[model samples]
Target: MALGSLSHGFSDWAPGHAATANHAPPKEMSEEFGRAAEAILIALESLRSSVDLAELQREYLTFIQIILNEGLGSVLRGR
Candidate 1:
């Protein structure tokens, strides 16, 4: 998905922003977020910083951990 498509209006970002009362956003949104997450991970891996290599590894792992802990099945379910 294009990065431009990710920018939603204010209401779109609000809690329970779904077609109905659902815990997860729509599948499309989740997929888009997945793409965005990958892009972020790539940057986190490639960029150099004064921060220790261990810190960057922690950041990368933490990002994946957040998504997995949430449960991918729940995250992609459509409202």
Candidate 2:
């Protein structure tokens, strides 16, 4: 997989170029992906109720959308 799209989950977390810079993404991604997912899992576990998790979920989706759109725009612009 390309650095840009590497993720354990369907969600892509790391920025493409940065993800590739440190090492080939797939190798680095396993560790990095787990850490990010674990952090969110921990946050959900800490939450008092499902509502809190839902709120986090919304925010996370929005964040991912923004990243994806930016990446797409950059690509369209030939960057």
Candidate 3:
């Protein structure tokens, strides 16, 4: 997926600004985040109609861990 252009306000910021000085989230990273968020939402919806509560809970936790540990945490750490 193509990286959407940075918003005008962010794009126009002074180089001294933190948002400008620090690298914006890379394009691939941003796209991955979007995909991961969608996956989590889908998982939640699927779990809602699931019959086995324990299995649902296990899957939900696994999904959450992947999002937090791999997706969000890695992003925050500037991977």
Per-candidate clashes, comma-separated: 0, 0, 0
Off by over 4 Å in 3: 1-21, 49-79
Among the numbered candidates, top TM-score falls to 1
lDDT of model number 3: 0.45
Stretches > 4 Å off in candidate 2: 1-25, 55-79
User: Model 1 residue 14 lDDT?
Assistant: 28
Order of candidates by lDDT, top first?
2, 1, 3
Computed on alpha carbons, the lDDT of every model, listed in order, comes to: 0.48, 0.49, 0.45
Candidate 2 lDDT over 1-79, as tens digits, reads 1222333244344455675444433434345544555566566676737785677656654544434544455568999
Of models 1 and 3, which has the larger lDDT? 1
Please estimate how well model 1 matches the true structure, expressed as its whole-model Cα lDDT. 0.48
Q: For model 1, how does the per-residue alpha-carbon lDDT over 1-79 read when each residue is reduced to its tens digit?
A: 1332233320232233365335444556655556666765566567646477547546544544443333464657842
lDDT, residue 21, candidate 2: 41
Pairs in steric clash, model 2: none
- Give me the runs in candidate 1 sitting further than 4 Å from their true place: 1-21, 52-71, 74-79
- Whose TM-score is higher: candidate 1's or candidate 2's? 1
- Give each model a TM-score: 0.41, 0.34, 0.35
User: Which of 2 and 3 is ahead in lDDT?
Assistant: 2
Looking at candidate 1, the ten consecutive residues that score lowest on lDDT are: 4-13
